[model samples]
Target: MRTTKLPTIELSLVTLRSIQKKDFKDFFEFGKDKETTEFLTWGPFKTLKDAKTMLKYIYFKRQQRNEPIGYAIVSKETSKMIGTIEYHTFNHKGNSCEIGYVLHKDYWKKGIMTEALQKVTQIGFEVLDLDKLVIKHLRENIGSKKVILKNGYKLVAIYEKQHFHTKTGQYHDVFVYEHWKK
Candidate 1:
């Protein structure tokens, strides 16, 4: 049976657990913060319904397909959802997956993301049996790059002018990252 318990990832100031429907409110606040989502694929949520729908879809996907694992970062002391993370893009035949994460601005610079990434990467290689893992960050998202690097992912390539960014309405570069099982 699929586990109902959310995996725990501890950091200096917070913990990470599977994202839940109840976290929609906290997620809405974080996702709607322009500065917090400036480098994300989709964010700066326009409405509460938008955030709720997105979180619901993610939770449903986790329950149904067991892929695209999504988690909420929570403050350890307060037990409040503060952010999110995902391990997605499974390639069955290729024996690989990709990862991504986001943290609330209030929790930035506290090494929370780096700790979360380490745990997620361990799950990818150990539980998921992935042979390789990949990650990408918007070229200018320095915080994301730092977390990935701290978790042992190596810079691979730059997909220059790759995505037509919706927020900026222009092409942007993405830094490719990769990690291999030893």
Candidate 2:
């Protein structure tokens, strides 16, 4: 099930809004970076076709129907799409979901994800009324670790070879975490 009102989180640095068709080029800008997608399970998007397919199937279709599945993190200063974040996996029966996100390489180490995550966490608890929120990160990704932990997500497990990274062509251990609504 989807929320009746698609979330629109406002923050000092960025505004999390529904991804738009006008953001196509900006989306491609970050999605196509091999370095940016290094630890991610998906994307170093090769072609505009790949970008369009992903944007349409994953974001646009739902957005057009008025229930956006995710958000585009638009920078306030430049007003450009810098990243995407959302509860990618939903479990209404359990009242929990998995959060996922990606940011432009240039924006890394700027505390952007942490700020965005704080807002998303608020939405999961306050807006969605979810009982808990789950998140995962590649063990090697210290950046993800920091963001997850900074938002009060607790480490639950380290599953061995849990993810097959397409870019690396190898399996890597994954760390699972959860944030109980409090």
lDDT of 2 by residue, 25-93 (tens): 888889899888887776888887777788889766655544436889999999999999977666767
Q: Give the TM-score of each candidate.
A: 0.91, 0.91
Regions more than 4 Å wrong, model 2 = 1-4, 61-67
lDDT (Cα atoms) of all candidates against the true structure? 0.80, 0.84
Please give, for residues 11-35, the per-residue lDDT of candidate 1 as tens digits.
Answer: 7777777777888898898899999
Candidate 1 Cα lDDT to native: 0.80
In model 1, residue pairs whose N, Cα or C atoms come closer than 3 Å (at least 3 residues apart or on different chains), thus clashing, are: none
Total clashing pairs for each candidate: 0, 0
Candidate 2, residue 174: how far the Cα is off, in Å? 0.5
Candidate 2 has an lDDT of: 0.84
